[model samples]
Target: MKTLYTLGLALVLTPLPGLVQAQASAEPEIASYSIDTTLKISTDRKTRGVSDTHGEPGLELTVEAAHESGLIAQLQLGSVSRVNYPEGNNLNAMLALGWRGGNPEGWHYGLGAAREWFPGARVDEAPAGFDASFTPTGWVNTRFHTSYLVAELGWSYLTARYLYVVSRDFRGANTATVCGNYLLVKLPSGDLGPALDCYGSAMQHSRGTQLLDLDLSYPLNGQTKLVAHLGWQRVRNFRGLDTMDYRLGLEHQRWGLVWGAELAGASVRNRDLFIAIDTDGTMRQMEKPKLILTVAKKF
Candidate 1:
């Protein structure tokens, strides 16, 4: 994990020493860069019906660079803490490069490639009587060494994205594809407030999953906003594996700094794997209904 972080940081910080020089003198250079850091504190750290952080807080950092020619690159690094794996913090990193074009206000399209890495994740053996030996450990690792290609098209307030699994196998699947659609609308600042966003995704694979989300945001004042989210996820080919999640948050932003507090919860179903807690305060699965605090800065 340390090595991966070092390498990613190096790539992010290194300058394109000769590329710009090779370009034609008539062309102008338009470069932009930004750094964002976030601190997240949560009651439970679960994703996709699986607990990865065992109800703990996490931190993340992202850096992005882009050029007017539509080329962009991004690097992100984060820490994962699990109650069962207290010996070390699981580290994850993602590196992506892409190109985007078209008008932001009218129509736009983008194509990108991304590589996600998990260095400290391991496959755990199932407990006695379980048919499957390879179960995902609650260690913040999907154990997925994957590379994917993404394509997106957007017009006005609607956008669609498709992701193709370019790697031979991601996790345990040999091939997988996912498509997502989003709708966003700006509303008047009345009782219900200002914005509405809806998103849905369908994944194709042996154990496919479908996800849907609705988010609404209301402006409380000039610098504060109230946000609410409702989400549903269902796993195909498996009955009784549906889950519902919701979140309510209040955020304030000023001078490129943002802070928020949220209450979130999820319902567990029979198909979800149950994590057990031992007498020594060690937790195997995550618990639901989390309180979260977030602080972020963009530069």
Candidate 2:
């Protein structure tokens, strides 16, 4: 009787191998993460409907990582135009950190901040013997580095984003001498065309510049979509430099590659404010309407 009792006790205390394995498999798994990369080549790199590539071709690479918990981080680097960022390294670098949540089929919201760095880029210094006292602090020699905060809201197929500049300048737009000055462009008719005041103030920093963007993407088919965008760039204290920009584009995905073509242009209060002068003294209107083409691959 005692031997029988001992055998029964052993059988009750030890779990079967199959049961143990089943219990282990039933436990929930930790959330997983993924990293993605994209490389792109485009006829022109435009920011807010203004050309950053001076109507030239550009290359860009981006890396992004996402977690199941709705956090994302991204880094992008691209080649820029010397005419657009005179005296600067022809490089455009941006780092963005943000969190996004909600169902893609429903509503979504996001908040982020980004910094744009243009290494060694600066505007021409104040004219010789110009009154230095009229300029704001660090205005004459500061590089073209800008930081901004962004907020986003969207539903299916439509989204709106607002970006507020927190930096001293908006891509070096608020230089001291350029304020209240006329941007003069010589016309082919041997005359100066329409001129407008810069409307910026020497004593003011461009810390409050803001951009509002509205975008729409409507699927035309399983692999192609119609994209449209409208945006306004408001330069605080320099309203004359404000612009309204628009884009109409189509994007298609096939064979693991994405192709895009867009018509982009901006209506500025004055075109001269968007004109870029190269080191060679040639000027290119950066906001003119143009067709931009792009191809990108993801990994």
Candidate 3:
């Protein structure tokens, strides 16, 4: 009887070691991150001077390099047009590279930059928050990120206008100044453009504005999380402009499947100079702030 009992105990303990080894081999021991989609919208109000206002949809397709590694990147496509800039729209692209490490490797940190190009605008001088430059738009961006903090800096440049290749507006306005427009660029002669300047333009033709973005994230469980971000931007132009932007998100996850909802906002207005690009025809503006939802899966 004693010999039989000893044999049974040996068999059970031997199987336990094999089970532990299999479990360790089944888990990933490298670095990686996930790719997500971002949808954002914004709106304006009555403080600066506007009779009417509206909103629109903007979409962004984002990517991640590795899961265990903190390195990442992103791409985006958006449309914005209203009064004097209607037929006008924009395409913006950006990238980010960073590191992830620390206690439990939950904290991520790194730095990188981005460049954006904007074309097809009805107006020129009066600059919006996200639009690149007028007639051949581009900017150089710098970014810093950590577990709970983010910082960014940008410097923009103007490329030669390739449109029509006949207009002189492109010829007069092709310099890289943080304040004031290129040259022929002019703002809408109404409350819309003026009010925007007061609230957010930093004056007009703002070149390299300063931006600081802060974020905090909380994990509810292994597959669910929440995040909130607050941002501030300042630009130098004919006058100084300031902006406040906020975003909150809730996300659910289940291995390769993810979905989320977000609310974002911005307060912007202006009162400054004007630069018109395709005038005498039709002009429009593209700006909005609406709720957004999205879902995605990985293979």
Candidate with maximal TM-score: 2
Per-residue CA lDDT of model 3 for 26-103, tens digit only, reads 322333345555453323221111111223343444554544444546554444233323333444343444443333
Number of the predicted model whose lDDT against the real structure is largest: 2
What are the per-residue Cα lDDT tens digits for candidate 1 across 28-110? Answer: 33344444444444444445334555566766777777666788788887665533333334776789899989986678888
Residue pairs with backbone overlap in model 2: none
Better of 2 and 3 by TM-score: 2
User: Per-candidate TM vs. native?
Assistant: 0.55, 0.81, 0.46
Worst 10-residue lDDT window for candidate 1 reads 176-185
- Candidate 1 overall lDDT versus native: 0.52
lDDT (0 to 1) per candidate: 0.52, 0.76, 0.38
Error of model 2, residue 193, in angstroms: 13
lDDT of 2: 0.76
Which one wins by lDDT: 1 or 3? 1
Which is superior by lDDT, 1 or 2?
2
**Deviation (Å) of 173 in candidate 1:** 8.7
TM-score of 3: 0.46
lDDT of 3 at 197: 34
Query: Rank order by TM-score, top first?
Result: 2, 1, 3
